[model samples]
Target: MLRIVLLFLALGWNPVAGAAEMGDDGLHKEDWFSITFRDVAEDIVAAKGEGKRLVIIFEQRGCIYCREMHEKLLADPEVRDFIKANFKVVQYNMFGDEEVTDLDGEMLTEKTAARKWGYVFTPTIVFLPEEAPQHVSVRDAAVATMPGAFGKWTFLNMFRWVHEKGYQKDEHFQTYHARVIQEMRAAGRLDAE
Candidate 1:
């Protein structure tokens, strides 16, 4: 028992090792998230130039669901790596005072922008297409919007679907997610539990 305990300690194992870092704004912060001017149009162009899709995530301080997502789903190495490779992520505080320039050329604070975008949840994620329509707000131009927290499989499948431009296909996200789940199960990558 003593030797086993010592071995475990030497391996530096900890279940909570993957917890996300908190920013001064009290929101979860990831290294992969871009530090941008919050100009939606410019950000979209930059993301496309990098061969990445643009993803804007809205989160607030002290949101338990956001914490759950950061720790449980986003913390998974596979998910994190996938997002980093394929997406340019930007974070906005749902109630913050930071200025944001909407795709429609409307300038507003982050809080007002969230309201205009109809994001009432703490962890609303908006995925944008490579080319946004002129004179349209983000709400009108977004290809997909994921509200609130979700399990790992659902979250990962959503990312995959958006990255693949599934919104242009006849198969819906729900169906795509189901198919991915089935494939994962068959591959023994998902636990029955």
Candidate 2:
């Protein structure tokens, strides 16, 4: 138990969270995650129609970090509920063979798309702006990208930052996260938890 807690601490995870569940594909499943045709443009449009932003998460089967993300940050209701309310999430398998259409209208397999996007990590999250420029790849159109799993606070703050369009502001994410943490500490929220 001590070792597990230490591991979570080393990984920057809060250690108080839990998992959603695993699917037959060996990936974690979230009921609210969108099932799309894997077309970036269409997905963006759909998300916009629903008044939400599009977010794509790339994961591979049997990835420990991916499992960590699902089991820890994503499983928490506070984190999960905010994302579900504000964003349209799409899951993509890093090594999958499913067809995916890029924003540039180029069709490729999931594996190829991941390669094209230069995603080198499982659970790489790409957050797209409300308007994606045509003839550009998803990576090029992405407003922000999280390259790997982070702690619950960091993860939730990233989502909040993106939802609030904080990227367009002068305050960077790290700074925003720090400020949020400080506020939480000042309010005694972190201490209560």
Q: How far does residue 56 in candidate 2 sit from its true spot (Å)? A: 0.2
My TM-score estimates for the predictions, one after another, are 0.90, 0.88
Which whole-number lDDT from 0 to 100 does residue 69 have in model 2? 85
lDDT of 1 at 193: 20
For model 2, what is the alpha-carbon lDDT of residue 30?
85
Worst 10 residues of 1 by lDDT: 13-22
lDDT at residue 120 of model 1 (Cα atoms):
100
- RMSD to the true structure for each prediction, in A, is 2.6, 7.3
In candidate 1, what are the lDDT values of residues 77-135, reduced to their tens digit? 88888998999999999999999999999999999999999999979999998985789
Query: Residue 30 in model 2: shift from native, Å?
Result: 0.9
Which portions of model 1 miss their true places by more than 4 Å?
1-18
